[model samples]
Structure formats: C-alpha cells, structure tokens
Target: MVSAPLPASALPQDSKDRLRLWIRLLRASRTIEAELRERLKQQFDTTLPRFDVLAALYRSPEGMLMSDLSRYLLVSNGNVTGIIDRLVSEGLVLRARRNGDRRTSIVRLTRAGSEQFRAMAAAHEGWIDELLGGVSGNDTQRLTAMLKSFRSNWEGRE
Candidate 1:
C-alpha cells in the first residue's frame, strides 16, 4: 500500500487537531506509565496491569467476577484469567465458586492483597505528586476540570 505524504496546510483542520491531541496524550501517558512501572517494580515487584487488577478488586464492594475484572481492566478474558492464576498462586487473591453458581467464580483480594494495595496506592500517589509538583495547585485544579469537561463532552458524542 502506498500512502501520500500530507502537507500540514493540506490536512483537514479537525484531523490536525485530533492528531496533535492524540500525540500529546500518548506521550504523556507513556512517560507517566513508564515512571509508575519503574517505581512499582523497585518498590513492590509488581507491574501496572497487576496493580490495575488489584485496584479494581479493591474497589468492588463484594469482590468481582473474572469477567467483570476483564471488563474493568479493559483486557481480554484470557489475560484476566492469567493474571488471576498468578495472583491466586501468590496467595494475594482468592477465587471462589459463587454460591449456587458453580460455573461462575468471584475473586477477592486477600488481607495481604489489601495491605499490598494500600502501600502501592500510596506510592502511586507519591509518584503522581512528583510528576505534577512543579505545576501550581490552581493550575492543576483547572486542568483537571478542563479534562473532565472534555471527557464529558467526548463521551456525550455518538
């Protein structure tokens, strides 16, 4: 497949705006995620996906099913299953066949898992603080509000 080079002036205005927004988002996300992962490894010997799963489980009032975890993490069922397998093997998570539902399993964070998650959550917040400390508090608030507004508008679309 052959693609023609796009001159900046020739590109649609909306296309250029979308491209710039995506590029900024991707770069910022990557840098922040990379730093978070590095700190997680150094401090907790965990990865972002594992932390994400545990964080989701931490938020569930009655725990979460494997399918629910997959959806919450925006990952494939196979991926969630593999993550569950490892966490269960490490005794950080418990998987039980739901009452009256042998085919469905609900997973919960164990006491140890909760403690680990709390520590990780603290460290994660510290990392975020480190990243944004240079920015003024008011600016941070405005930026967060703007992002929320943008997200609301974006979700309202389509």
Candidate 2:
C-alpha cells in the first residue's frame, strides 16, 4: 500500500511554479509525440523509430556504420539492428560489410528509401506546423531559446 503524494499547494511558491512548468513541458512533449507517432503510422505506415532511422540516414548520404547509427540515435545496437533488418528487407536500406572489417557493417538509404523519406519528411513538417500553430513565431523562438538554454545549463550535471 502507498499513501497519496502531497498536493501542489503544499509546496513553496517557487517550487510549485517549477513543478507546474515541468508538468506543462512534459505534457506538451508527450502530446506532440503521440500525435506524431499516430500520424506516422496512419499516413506513412511507419513508426517514429523507423522515421528517425531514415532521417539520420538521409542526412548522411555517404552512409553510417551500424555502431555510429546506434550512437547517433542514442539507442542500443540491438535495437538498431532490428530496425535495420526490417529496412533492408523492405528494400529501403542496404547493409554491406565494411572494407577490411568483416565484423562491421555500414548502412545507407537506398534510392527508393531516400525518395520515400523525402515525401514523409515534407508531410511531417506540415503536420508539426499545424499542430503548433497556436504559438506565435516569436513565442516559438523564445520558447525554443529558453529550452536550449535550460538544456545547456543542466546537461552533464548528473
């Protein structure tokens, strides 16, 4: 059994305000992410992780090593391997052994993959714009800058 947590009114003013800000940020993030995931599934028949993988590969036309892809995506190699396997099977990506290193593989988007990703990306941008339309451009810029600053200040702080 567990007791209920204290209400927000019990906290000090500053603490309460910070808590509220955190909650709002989290809620907004989750809402947007859920919307994006649903849109991706419905419109593109894809998942966010898959879109992310394709986006990363699209940025690096020359290709990326499997290890590098995992690192860049901040996911484990096994997770990446599964997604890569699916993409390869779908003819959307190619995986080839690196020269002089049979143990390593490099992955890149195929021409078909690149074209498909471009289309998806365009629709994604439009969806995001529509979703965030309530915020003015100035507010968006200010909020973005504040978030960047917050991340910069807190990152690697443990």
Candidate 3:
C-alpha cells in the first residue's frame, strides 16, 4: 500500500483518478467526522454513534427495530445494546417488545430525546453550514450531484 504516490498524469489511464478520489474521500470523511465529534461533544455531550442512532430514529416513520437501528447506525447488535441502554437510562429512548414478537424490540426517541435531537440537529446544521458555507450554492449543488453520481456508479444501483 506504500507504493509511490504517483502524480495524476503518471497514473494508469483507467484506475488513477478513481484511486485518488477514494483516497480523498477517506481523508475527508475522517477529518469531517473528527471535527463533528468534537463539536457535538462540546455542545451536546454526545458521541457520533449516539448522534447517529438518534438521528436515525428521529427519521423513522414509526420508530424502528433494534436490528434496523444497528444496521442503520453501522454498528453491531451489542454496540447498539450499549447505546440503547445508555439512551434508555438517560430517558432519551424507550424500547418496547413488538406485539406477538417478544424477541423483537422497537426503539423510539422519547419526547426528551426528540427535543434533544432537534436541538442538536439545528446546531449541527449550523456547524455544517459554517464548515461548508464558503462554497457557493451552485458549487454545493454541483458537488452534491457529482457525489450522488459517483455513489450510484460505484454501487451499480440506480
């Protein structure tokens, strides 16, 4: 993996650009995630994974199963259990075993949790805006479009 960091022009005709893009994406994600975590921690005493679960639940149409939350949060069931336990203890989330399905538990953001998520989301939006605000609307749109295209292409899905 320590091959020469070949110049763009020096890269193989086919794979160079994509490799460069992947490198940039990984670096950018790490930087942004670190920054967001710091900001969220300072403002809300929340970790990124916690925020992610809340955000996912906040968007669920009618709450969500623990399994779904784990998948959406990209975490393991045990990890989700830890998070859910903490959230429940904080009165930020409530879990109920699905009717006729004792093995399946549904999790929902409590009133307090929903309010907290809203507040955090507002601040988060502002932070993101502050971080990317320098870019013009046109550029932002173009970037989104490009990213969407890249994702679709990479995933081989519509």
What lDDT does candidate 1 reach at residue 69? 89
Which candidate has the highest lDDT of all?
A: 2
lDDT per residue, candidate 3, 30-111, as tens digits? 9888999999999898999899999999999489999988987778999999999999999999999999698999999999
Superposed by TM-score, candidate 3 places the C-alpha of residue 17 at a distance from the truth, in angstroms, of 2.9
RMSD (CA, Å), each prediction: 2.8, 3.0, 3.6
Candidate 1 at residue 115, lDDT?
A: 92
Model 1: per-residue lDDT, tens digit, 1-158? 99988999999999999899989989998998999999999999999999999999999848998888898787999998898899999998999998969888899999999999999999899899999789899998998998999898888466
- What is candidate 3's local distance difference test score? 0.90
lDDT of 2 by residue, 1-158 (tens): 99898887787899988988999989999999999999999999999999999999999999999999999999999999999999999999999999979999999999999999999999999999999999999999999999899999998886
Model 1: residue 90 alpha-carbon error in angstroms: 1.1
Clashes of each: 0, 0, 0
In model 3, the worst 10-residue window by lDDT is 149-158
How well does each candidate superpose onto the true structure, as a TM-score?
A: 0.86, 0.89, 0.86
User: For model 1, which pairs clash?
Assistant: none
> Once superposed on the true structure, which residue ranges of model 1 sit more than 4 Å away at CA?
1-6, 12-18, 156-158
lDDT accuracy of residue 47 in candidate 1: 94
In model 1, the Cα lDDT at residue 140 comes to: 89
**Clash number for candidate 2:** 0
